[model samples]
Target: MLLILPLGISYLLRTDGIATDKYIDDRRNYIEQVLDTIDSSFSAYEQLIYTTVKITEELAPDKAEHEAALKLAFSSSRSALVYGIGIWYEPYSFDEKTERFGPYIHHIDSNNNKEEITYFWNTPEYNYQNREWYKTSLAAKEGEISVSPPFFDSDYTYITFGIPFSKEGKKTGVVTVDIVLPQLQGYLSDYNFSDFSGVYLTTKDNSIVFSKTDASNAAIEKHAMEGEQPGLFTDRTAVYDENEITSFFEGIGQKPEILTSETENGVFRIHAFLDRKAIFLNIIFRHSLQYLIFFLFWTSVLYLIIFNSSYLKRNYENRLLNTENERLTEEIFKRKEAESRLTFQAYYDEVSGLQNLNSFMEKEEALQPGNDNRSLIQVSLNNMKELSLILSSTIIDETLLAFTTRLKSVCPLETRLYRARGFSFFVVYDDQKTGSSQKLAEKLQNEFRFALRLGSRDIRLRAKIGLVYFKDAESLEQVLAMSQSAIAGLDVADSGRVGLFDHSVQEQKARHVVLDAAMSQPGFISELYMLYQYIVKTEDRSPAGFEALMRWKSSVLGSTVSPAEFIPMAEENGLIIGLGWFAIEEVLKAISGPLKNSGLFVTVNVSPIQFIELDFPDKLDNLLNQYAVDKNRLKLEITESSAAAAIESFWQIIDELIRRGYRLAIDDFGTGESSFHRLYSMAFDTLKIDRSFVTGLNLDERNQEICRSLMNIGKTMGSQIVAEGVETEEEHRVLREIGIKYSQGYLYARPQPLSETEFGKS
Candidate 1:
């Protein structure tokens, strides 16, 4: 038993020795990492200090003789530097008559202080004779630099980096920069260590420049409290004594590899103790080696268990992996099938695998507004209607297919065709000037003439082709409607060869003779003024508080062309920007005067094209200032479709308007494909529910839910909510109940001229 006990003890001793060595090695690595972190932190500090100095020097160029030095500093490629970036000097009063430095020095706080005259210098009252830093810099020649020891100057002790200024060969003046010691000290103080550790900056003479020392705790006290220099002790044991100073560093020259030499910017050195005692203790107690010992013990045990179970585990894992692989394969197959289905559905029309309604609309919408000059020709198959009446449904289907193929041959490659319900067809034709609607009508007439002439033997076909040139159409919808109307007229016309519907033909004739006269009204803003004062300014919530837009009213026709009609005309005529400026100014005037204390804001709907004017901000600013109204009290309403067209410029305009104090609200909120992400990015201050959404509230829960979601989103994204098209009191009450703060509709008042009564009602 005695022999076994000694053997166990020996084994334990050997294991402990190995663990201690490993611990020491791990601790060395950890110390190195900590030192590296400290080095990086010091480097950052140097950069911050240099940047601060350079920034100050740039800002304070008026300081005497510093501008040239700063300009040189900026031209350098090196981003980091210690000194030579800036020079700091005190302002001194010199007496020419006395030819001496002043006896009294004015303090930085503008207080006068008196002190005995220590010495005098060449620059009159500039007392440079006895000052250490001044003397050190003045004595040093050009291309030489010196760092002064920390000294007291008016209750504050700070360090200085000084270099002598030279012209040609001789020294002219001393340039110096003050260093904040406490800032550097505080920077070093951030590193906490209970184990014995200290940071110090020193000079070549072994003088301590800065040190981490506690005056109260002698055990952790600094080696030197106050002294001319530091040197090695006689006894190593006395080194730890509180009274005796143990030289922390041998000398700057003792270690040349670790030591750095002085340059124009001053020396930089990084050194630490390699044979410190506490560091050895820290190494022996390192946590990693202890963890490693336990890790190896468990790992050896785990390996044995794993070895025994390897075959069974391997078979189980293989089966699991195979199952996962099969599932993945099935998923991939299903995904491919779904993708093919989606691809087909995206392009194919639901009813017949041809172009869909969306395709036709997209083509029409994509046409460039002014330059295209495209003409639309809509052809309705009259024979199909007759076929539907006389033949079986299957026979009618066959004839419709044959008719589509024939139409495909005649239609241009760029033209879009839609299967408009049962027997009607819609087609859009692009720019072709010489080929008049008459020529198209005659061509279609000829194509059918042969079909009709042959009857059953030759394949009879008869239809009316409605033609409308888009030169006078106000919008895509207008053009589409006109074309369809022309086609509708032909659907009932006498059975014959293809012919243009008389309405479009008559409308075109009317548009030509009266088009200029129709367009010859006052510009959009001139009408906007009338609209703002009368129709748009109504208390009725229909277009209630909203600025109603004006359309041209012709005395002869009795029908009015809407603002949606004339505004685009105004833009095409190059008058929209001017009109936009006028509206903005007029709104500002109203908001600043009658609406001043009413908590009421004026909103003017602006065309996106008006933003192209670079002086929009200047005009807005002028109007904002002229009215003496806060910019926030005015709003600019922009349509979502227009905003999306010029999104980047739209954002810029919105940003500038906001910066100048005006609010922006997106008009027609649920009418476009404005994604929530896009809405979030826009950061609009207000959202106006589109009239369609408001009108659909009672009928469509989906519409109501969408408006509700938008209102919720607006609240989350910091926007005020407004709902338009409230014709009934129920609509107004419903909107208010849904947290909509503002509404514009017929429930309140129709737009009328603003008066004392109008103001009172508001």
Candidate 2:
């Protein structure tokens, strides 16, 4: 018994050390995951700020232009994390016209539960040029983005991210975006942590950005400043030293097992503290059975030693051994059950009771090269969002479960089903079982045609299915991405559509990948240039004005990409915003330079994405002011489809643009629905007939009558009519007979570079 006591003590010490190490490792992993989330959020904000800087740096340093550009930039990319965004110029640096020129745009939640974007300019009293964020950003090395430490401001804490903007090799200003600390805290709160665990995020200077503890920030900072050693489980058994660390633990009233980790950039530190008592309790609970078993074994050994009767001792030993064995078996079974539960939670969808994307990825990874022909189909419910708005969350969950059950019923027994994401499922099957992917996709679509009964409601759902066949030689990631692209290519207006990732889809995806990469490269926009096509009067074939059409000649592709291809790609990828700005500036430059004395208004096409921006009119005014061009000289052409599909806000933008002295034209007028109603609603300056109608006007009497009717409608509405795609003399004559005043097409002259056009030559 004396020897056993020492051995037991040694075992307890070893077990305690192992448990402490394991706990530390587990907490470290948790901290890492938390850091990952924080990093991802921060990265998104960084990209936004970077894009804003890129847009702001090119502005002409006018106050109105800066205000409009800053407002537009902030509003277009607004995020929940951002409190505000601003531009701070050096003293008398902006346009060299003022001592201070800082413009800030931020959101204000009004009493009516609506967000209002408020704009503010720096006053003499509030000189933002002298602020820490601005000064630090200006002092930073060229091209370096600076992240300011959290500071208290206006009843909230904020961390500012700023990048210095330069003009002609000299730093002239700083562009910054501010993140609200409480919003960050809200993000962190989404993660689940132990009740006894506290997490704190701090800057390198030990200023707390967020803390889960009840201690005040000042107390935490003071404790950190006193040089408290940050280590994993350092002195884990030590009690709280009241005199030395009382302030830090004033609220907790207990010692903490602290673990600290710094971000890779060393900008921020994460401190995770577990209550020492809680840690010890958890450790004891985890190993109590092992300790009990050890004690029982020793007790049985002593019992055997004390008893000399062979039969009685044997019986007693057998019973004790059997009891210990049963307990051990039970413990093993419980552990296995826990492991199985964890595995299910990791790889299976909780709502659908099916395997998840992780399991699908694992299956994909395990596929052999010569395996049977397998096809992957992704089925996505198209109306989940609409249904969610009208139904309770419980109903939505029930609908998802019902949908998955129906999907499983339709799929072959040999098929493997996976929950890809919300209301989306993936089915994998070999050709032998499903016969063909097309047949299976059709069957699934047919199944969704029937109404699903849920309690008292009959819910009808539409699905989009994207299928891809693979021989296991291709990368599954690429296959999956292709499937997604195929799904995206399906018309949103259509329901129950099935698409295959065919050669055309593959080519389009490749082109988009290449275009996205090329556009991301520095100075890629320099490869883009504008061509001018003459808009001539139909009566005399005399040039009235020109349409500025953007063209791109990619050095990377060794060919010129047609606008038909890249424009849609640009719109999809959000590069259209930058490209739209480029087009505006280029057209204004041409009007103010080469075509200054021409007395002709150059029309620029405005994409719906750009036109719908709330600050579109203001941005246009800014550009016009910067270039010193008359707003009337640069016409904005929005597509008829865009106008027809526009909401009430679209009219507001159009009205504002017209109020600011810009002429608006509806391009491709005849192609959209309800043309007469749309024309009657707004006072458009010009109407451009679609190319399709004008293409065969000379040959088809129906097209000629259509063109004539459209021209009459435009004339009746006091709008000038322009006929497009007049390729020959006969088409031009037909347009003239139809009383179309303006015409633009190959018949006048093929679109030519500015230098080769009459305006540039003059």
Candidate 3:
């Protein structure tokens, strides 16, 4: 929320800046355009008045006909302009009894003007002698114009425009024009010039004649008729003081951005007031949608934070209220404390009173200075993972405690013990307490003879111990690491009861490190090439097909890495996906080039990871379609261990692969729990016997029986049984006698690269 708030504020401020930039000029220009429009509208009235004055003067001035002048007035009234057009003469111009000739008003009811003129009666109020236009224009020069003080009627208040019309060398009469106040305002409505909320027009005397702001104010009316400074309009706006301007602005609600333009050479002024609030309001209106979107965005973000914080607060309070849980936790801690009695007991195992893996490592490191002869023994419990599936956690924990108690009694009292993991334990003893690894092994084996009784069950725990003797030649971590590797390979049923970590194990580990580093470099995949090993049918010892084995001659190592060493390394490090794809492409290329039309098929090894990949199916399909290779000629060998792990996913992948026209085989079948169960349950075209069983077929009776049984099972499952590692004819003869369908090994031919392999030569 803190981060989001600043960002949103900056965005809104940026929007405001952009809005101002885009709209300010538009507002100013709008005012100018509006003023120009009003100026143009008034210009038309000035032209009409001048044209009417000329036409009226051309009319016959005799007493017999005033109808022509009145007719001109009626034509001017067609525009709904002023109250009416009138001609007011100088007093007694027509006769001694007459003050004015006629003011032939062309108002809404002025159709009966002919009758009024025929029986004309002049009231004193309607007399032209007292009128402002008559007296002003009588004194005005021939071309001069005069304006009367605006007067009020029931519906309108207006001022009159007068021009002096003359006979030869005399000012005989005046032409007057009265513009209606309400009608003038209505005309101004179409000329929108600014964002002002109100508009009005004022006279040259600073008196407002027409206003949308306040039309009923007596002061403004008085100012229109009588003026402000002299209390009457002797002339112009020079008398308008600050108080009047202030009052004008106050009436509009604020100091409106009032733009005043002059139309009569600074006599009459047009005002367009653009309120400041209206400008901002317009800006807000323009950006309201964007503001709404940002509002929802910030609201959602803040709501999530507030909701999560509230949930956490309630959860914390609920936890605090559980007093019973605190008591149980304290009891568990006390029970764990009572199991180990030592100053450094915190570093020891909670279930068994032995030091933990961290403490064991610390103790081994501590013994480096002034170190006497030291031997670290690592004991591995072989079947704890299997037992965990069958036994309850409580029984397993109790069984482990009893086993550790037995181990402690057999060991020297001064020695320190440690539990490395759930299934592995560590013991550190110096030469002062133990004689040799052989004597220690015997003592450990002797202790194993007695079984512990746990809940009426005699549970015998079997373990393998890996021994390491040290004198600071290597770091304790390295020594313990070597011991763990040794223990991983040992079997509880083997004669090498206490395996010793040796030089061969270190060399293997070094080779593994070298291969791991080399696999990460460029062109590592180029180092890998396939060697085709021939498989012969037992029926005639003829070429059946070849299995593609991956071989590597690493440039960095300056030697070849055995497939046995680098293959598993690649699989574990996730480099096998790339390496496996490289092999597949090379094999397909071979089939597309020299091996085309050979009628012989080749088998390739695929890693479990690549087989289960989601994109693998599409990749293989594209490659096969591109190469135009027949599906029958390429078979993929899959490991049994991986197939059983993800049965459903593997089945789908295999089904798709076969549907696209390919074959499947189970490679190294006998290596991992070869019960022939998957051979019957899962889809497979062939079952390749592991090399281990084939190597011992002639020597071991059990190997001989297992092969015969596998062959029978393979035939029943309708899959051809292939025997690998057929190095000698004697072993091959035994496999041939066992009714094996195929055999592959060095006795037939060693694996050769594609360059050396002739398709039918095998």
Candidate 4:
């Protein structure tokens, strides 16, 4: 009996410890879940606030439409949020004799002649200056938005999101909407988790935006509304008055954790006494379900002892026999009984009805890995977006399904197929011993190219294949990643041709990454121009005249690169904007100081796309004024084709440039869609004939006619004609005979370094 008592007591303690650990884990999980829920809800509130602000800033303002939209948002939101939307207008400051502060209102009634007046009945009581929301919103620049700390209002304290609506280039007024914390708390209270107690929402700044506990008294409310006190209180563990409120600042910037404490209302270390008792009594009293089941079994055994000994033994033996008989019966019927429980999930892709990611994973595990000679091929379809535009949704699905079916026929039965990501695929070759990787790539390309040709002419489908030799990989992930990198590199190279990866592919890929980063900066083009000046023109002169030619200086390869190389790269990556800005700024700066007193003009080439900028002319004017440079010393050169292509907007941009006292020239004339009609209609100060026509004028009759015609056309259009690319005295004489007085070429100066007096004698 003594042994039994001790063993039972030890077992009970062990069981209780296990139960306590489980309870703690469950409680921790519940707390984390509550926090996640609140964070997600708050994120939704923020998105809505930003969205409303953006919409209002765009709306045509009688303020009527914006007000109606706000009303709609307020009404449609979750009921627990007391004020879904509110607009705060900066009030007319009497002291400043201007509108410098704000008045919170539900709507704006401009027709009542209350444009600058704060409406008393419809507006909130608190002055806007006293609120942090107003200060923070105003402090933010135009297009900036912010969220303020939660505080109580005269009506009700709720968490609020603030959005500043300003004129396109100015930040002046703001609109703020409150999302009541009670609503979020109410939504969270619906959780039926057995372990969760309360949820708290705090900002990164450690201000509590929402909390379930009502810790406010009159003094606390006053302090909070006055924005004088911090949002959180600090303690290890505490209880207040007879209230069950438990809060503290324990784990601030990490995962939330449980904190145990015991203190009471204004004065009591005495709660520690109760904690000790709780620990002593309940520490070993906790139990698990398994222990409960064991206790029930022992109780049944004890009850059996009270019955007639022989009779009870016989009854137990009979019960054991019946249980054995039932076990045998279950074994006999097992297969038949389990028939209804079996199920299989259908594997289908929503877009193409191909096998999905889950199905691929299951099949991949079942397949045997390929041997040393095998190559894993990955195929990615290029220009999927263009394909989507040309083909209908139904046709796209049908085409993909058909393509997959065709691919299956070419693939071996053991070969696995998967639609990896959108418009991409992976095929592992188990039998690459018979063929080389290159040969396989060629065969696959030929077959797909043929298939795509048969489909449609309006859209073209091409495959980029990346292969990995399985021998180098220790894991599937590394092999897959290497293959993808190979494919991406191939896409960049050959520009529409199929590329094969080799030893030097890594260096090529790294070069591209560096190039992208360097080109993203604003000064890439200007730096390139400076390099060009240093290399091609050895002399450096102040107040010098020079023509700005487009050149590509690669950030990837720290050297002067060819335009043929980087121009395509710039176009592909949309770095043209930065490049254009750099060119214009370089030209302006050159003219500002180098040509200030030299009587020289700096000419720069401009692209058709540059004219689309609405503020381009204004920006140019600002730059010129800032440098105190003469606008007449700056000239913009545009190709004839570019000007003719966008004719309607062409004259407007050109007229603005001319009106600003800058010169405009039609470059590469007689080459692109340049005609007498175009020259007569459009205004330009100069016409530059193409080098081909100028250089061949002495030998070829056709070239001479073109040069003479261009000169005639320039004369009729009230523009001076310049002949370029003159290489010999004969060519120069031919241009002079054609009446092209402004001549530039190797025959004259070979575009020599612009000395300070290069254009001073002209």
Candidate 5:
């Protein structure tokens, strides 16, 4: 008995030792996973800070634009991660007229909802420039992000991440994003291995960013109250007296087994703590059966040993078999689960949870050979991209799901719905059921009449439905193309409209394809030319300048394409940039060669896409220098709609052009939602009233008033006013009486080839 006892004891000790090592190793692995999650979260935050800096640097010169842009930078997902964000500029840097301009947007809990409030933090009592975070951020090297020590704000604890931003190679300001400690605490707590285990995120300075236990919080608070720094008492004292710290934890009924890990950047540390008492209890419970078996075998060694020996051996073998079976069962289940997940992902749209395009195609291909009566209706959300700009991705996803649900509710039973793309869906149903397709289209249109509740906002979505009856002769790709063409034929202004694939839509689509193909050819640029129309003084009918209009005569089509038809197509296909550059260079060449001594300034219309290019100013400068044309003789005309849609960088580009001595004009005024503030803020030299208001200005009172108002605005801004589309003497006389200075229309002269004009002949 005595010899057997020592052997059993040795075996038990070895088993317990192995189990303890494995347990600690598993906990350490869990800590590593938690650290990885923390690192990823912080990396995202750092990326957000970098994005904010880039956006601020680009839009800094415009106050309203940059502020709105900064606000937009924080989407719902990002906003939820951060407590607040602040943009602090050096004194008089943002605005030379003011000594300070610091915009701080902070989240506040209002009625149990989080609301963001924007306020200038440059006030006397709360000068952000004097704060430690700001000072440290400013001292940081270029491109380096600095993290502030954990600090308390009101009842909440937070840590600030700061990055310095520069403009034109000089540091201008510091941008900071604040993270709430409790939010991080909740995040880390989710990774706790058990209720008895605690997770903590701490800074390099030992300041606790987050701790899962009330006891840890109380201990940190006690240490803080005792004039020690706000950090873990055990961590601070362990270096000097480890035994004292162990005794302190033991006194509190917590002999903790702690595992510590540092982050890659060493900015933060992760500490995992498990109660020693709980570990001891778990070890005892796990081995209690083995201890009992050993005791029983040894106590009955004389008579029962022979019988019990086989019983014990069989029991051990059965346990091993059960464990192996469970492991194999779990692995098989996991593999099957993985395969099912992959199949679902491939066949379904993750956002809407609807069958995807691949699934739809497969279903369509597998249809019975005689099933030729299926009709496809594409329901498209028109403003999804626009909505994405202002709404959260979560809201957009929810809206899409709700749209699918609503669609399914209206769809006929047995009809299949598929999400063809992000902003569109396909509804395939039987068209043989007499007007079924028409009825379904009507139902889909009616569904959009009601608003969908997306987060806090209720928005009515606009959809365009295109219907196509599947023909046995047409392939699925051909049918899809026809449906898209049908949708394209419907006017965008006619929201919620349904259109059917017809001969006219097909002709238009074919014509568009031909034109696009012609425009894509390398020699298409050479085939393009320009015509100049006279912009004359309204009073004297004498030429002040010429407006350059682009003309396209495609050799491939063997016909001249109208500007209205091909210009928008060019813009859509990104060919406008090339066309715009060609027009600018051609106009300059005409000015420098044919009209050098003509003393007429020529204005060329610029597309919004071209005007927004970062290198637009440089490209224009190069063209101007290459042609040796006077900058004053080349005026750039930007449409009012384009001007209204201009962002902060647009204004910056405009300033660059003005500084280079180029004159700018706002063409087609009164044709869009014209803002007085925008016009007043811009540095335009001319405002050309659109032909719509000028065509009947002599007869229509409303038209006259609009023209007069536009003229008054132009005159007030010291800009030359020109009336477009003037066709008669009466219209010209009225425009003259309305204080117009310049006029460009058929009444003066039609657009003619610059080489055939009288100036070119001279």
Candidate 6:
């Protein structure tokens, strides 16, 4: 009996040890897999953040442009369920002087509904430059992604992803995406542990800890509390008390079998407890197991317990792994939802409930080749940005929405209207319903002529429309660009006017493109020289003086670049300032010989742009002094359209020129608005009648009346009346009958270069 007992004891101990060793290894391998999955899932989420940012920059570029869509990016994203996204912009984007703007903020409110917050002119003063993530990201390399430390807001734990924002291909801001994390302590609360073992995950650096309980219901009470969250702990000691720290060993009734693995700079460890009761049961039954009556039964029962423990160990490991996979699957699903929303918002504008710029581009790309009767109209609300400064953003948004309503009310059933960007709206229509562009523009104007009643404020609206007639199979970009460019070509005073795509503008654009490219060439400067034309005395066909006209005969262009083509372009691009300097220099060098001989004054046209330049007077003074030419003999023609704006602020320059004995003529006088105001207020050498009234002076009574009235105004103002564009002898005779002082056109002589200036003289 004694020998039997010893043999049985040896058998049981040997089997238990072997099984324990095998199961321990299996548990550890299982834990390593769980940790790897978590690390990979985190990396996947980070990639999702990058994807959202890239799409935003591609589609919206500027948040203020497609604000609704940006907010929808958060609301539609699976990430939004986990986190909120906000866009922070540079100061100049929204035109704020002191405070930076976060124009679109997509966040879950207290009710858990996704809400959008738009910040524009009325956004409160907050310096986003001082934010932690903002500073951190600015120091990071361009296009690099980063993660912020976990924090709590609205009782939800969060970690933020900071991404760079770019404008004009330069990084200017950051997109902050904040995600909510599950409460650390409660994450594993439902996990079940056997009497023989407990499982727990611990960080390698001892920063985070989570644990499952044993049969006693004892657990790690302070594994992840305020000590880890609010950062109340400095080191390991701060996380645990001297006696309570021993609870893991004390609660399990023995030193634990600890297993550890690494995860994202942290450790994931499991603590398994030894089953002393099972050991005691095995010992108590050892002597009885070998009895003759119960020998087979006892042996079968013993083997059963041994294999059952192994079974339980395997099942437990599988359960933990399953839990991890399920959680990761849920996260992946949410992330996909987020990505889909971003793509959808890519095509939709969330704020105004209209198609965005990206949608327009996509539609444009998708259009089929077919003959369709269509007219494209681009409407711009003039002074919208200025209005934002004066009125609240709420008011501006209301006005914009109201404007859309007005457009919808007047537009055809087949027409599609899209809010392009900012205050610009694009309308596409069937020509069968739209009639003519002029009628459409007039209808739109009349619709806006009445004030929009917004509570106590009756806000008036003013818009400039550009119309382009489309041809078969024309690309959307071509038509859209043509329409917008036509609008841009309108004179500043012509606001509320519809500029249609016309043959003249098309020719001008073709020449403008040619001139723009050629002006930068080395030959452009040498090609710029003055042509002299006769400013004839009215009674007899004789030259009284000469008007010096700057002409471009480009070798590369293979044609004469008209003043009508490149002059306005030069004024707009600030190239006219340089052109003015070049003209002054060349005219002085050319006419120094001519002026010395005839005492026949030469009038050179100067752009209004030159007067605004502080150095204009100095440049002109230096040119004249250098050549020693009389300033009176060098008259300066100021186009009436150019003089309208100049009459107020440019008077000092005008006075300086006049005081210096330089003559100033109002070129194309009667065609401009406020010509009479200029004629009455400013001192001038001549008021040249615009060519429109001059062409039909002998035929139309209205033209004759206008010419007579302008001559009387010139006489009263002590200014000379010069009739331009005189084509026939009859036109010249009528101008002479009206007592006009001077005339110039193709009548006496066309403007000929200094090489050909003596054609009429001979």
Q: Model 1 over residues 1-762: C-alpha lDDT tens digits? A: 235444544565556566655644554454445445544544433433343332332222232223332333333312212222334333332224433321221123211111121223446555455577677866765545565665544434455555654333344445554444443434444444232233334433233444543223433224344441232232111112212323333221121112122222333222222223334334445543444444444544455466767775566556656755786698699789999888666654544456655566664564455565677666666555434434666765566666677777776666666766445666666557344546655666566555522235345765667677666566777777777766655533344544443664767656645644555555423434434422122223322243634445555445666666557656544466776777777677677666667665667888876664555678777767777878777778888877765534445566676766667888888677766776786678888888888885766778778888988888998997777777876666567666676777666656654443356356
- Give TM per candidate: 0.35, 0.51, 0.38, 0.43, 0.46, 0.41
Clashing pairs in 6: 68-350, 68-351, 69-350, 77-338, 78-337, 78-338, 203-267, 204-266, 204-267
lDDT of 6 by residue, 1-762 (tens): 335545765776666666666666766676667667656645645555565565445433344434643554554454423456666665555453344446646554533454667664323465667767667655656666655554555555555667786667777677767655443333333233444344444433232344443433223334334232212122211222213433444443554455556666332333334444444444445434333223433444455566777776566556645755785697689789999899878877655667777777777543444665677788887656546545877998888887788788898767777887667888776676657656877678667768888889888766778887667326777777787776777754676577877767777677677778887787776787777888889888777788788888888888878888778877644478778877776667666875567667777788875775655677788888889887777777888876765423366578777777778888888777755654576679888899899896789889988999999998888888888999988888888888888898997888786666663343
Error of 4 at 71 (Å): 35
Q: 591 in model 5: Cα distance from truth in Å?
A: 20
Pairs of residues at least 3 apart in sequence or in different chains that clash in candidate 2: none
Candidate 4 lDDT over 80-102, as tens digits, reads 45354655554431234332333
RMSD of each candidate relative to the true structure? 36.7, 12.4, 44.6, 16.7, 13.3, 20.8
Clashing pairs in 4: 90-101, 90-102, 91-101, 543-594, 543-595, 544-594
Instruction: For candidate 2, write residues 1-762 as lDDT tens digits.
Output: 749956995788577878877877887888888886777667767777776776665565556666656666666564656778887777656444543456777657411223434433466767676677778877877667787777765545688888887766677788888887765655665566654355667765555676554444565555566776322112221222323333356434556677777776555677777666666666777878777777777776777778867887889888887887898899899999999999998899988899998888886655454564888888988677556545777998898899888888888798999987666788887887658878898888778888889999999887888887766335777667877876878765545568876677767767789988887778778899999999998999888999999999999888998998888878755688889999989999999999999899999998866766546777777878888998778888988887776544456567777777778898988888745765676678998999999887889999988988888888789898988888989998888777788899997899998899877887
lDDT of 6 at 346: 87
Candidate 1 ranges beyond 4 A from true positions: 1-499, 502-505, 508-518, 521-528, 532-561, 760-762
Positional deviation of 598 in candidate 4, in angstroms? 4.1
For candidate 4, the lDDT comes to: 0.56
> Tens digit of lDDT per residue, candidate 5, span 51-116?
678667766454577566556555422445587777888874745564345776766752133556
What are the runs in model 2 whose C-alpha is more than 4 Å off?
A: 1-30, 38-468, 471-527, 553-581, 607-633, 647-662, 673-684, 737-739
Q: Give the clashing pairs for model 3.
A: 226-232
What's the lDDT for all of these models? 0.53, 0.75, 0.68, 0.56, 0.76, 0.65
Q: Point out the worst 10-residue segment of candidate 3 by lDDT.
A: 230-239
1-762 in candidate 3: lDDT tens per residue?
A: 567767876777677767655565566566566556656666655655665665455444443345544554455344545566676565445665543356455455422222223212256656666766577766766665665656766645677777877655567677777776554554554455335544546666556654444223564555455443322222221333435554545553555555566664443565555555556656776676566556645655566567767776556545544533674587579667776454455587777767787776655654463464777788777656546545777988898998888888888886778898657887777776556655776578567666789978987666777887666335777777777876765753553477777778778778788889998788888888788888888768888887888899989999998988888887665577888888898889878876887776788988865765645888998999999988888989888776655324446567778777778888878777644554576557788888889885788889989888878777888887899898887898898787887998898989987677666353
Q: How well does candidate 1 match the true structure in TM-score terms?
A: 0.35
Error of 6 at 758 (Å): 2.1
Better by TM-score, candidate 5 or 2: 2
Q: What residue runs in model 4 are displaced by over 4 Å at the alpha carbon?
A: 1-425, 428-513, 521-545, 550-557, 561-598, 618-631, 659-661, 674-676, 692-701, 726-739, 745-762
TM-score order of candidates, top first: 2, 5, 4, 6, 3, 1
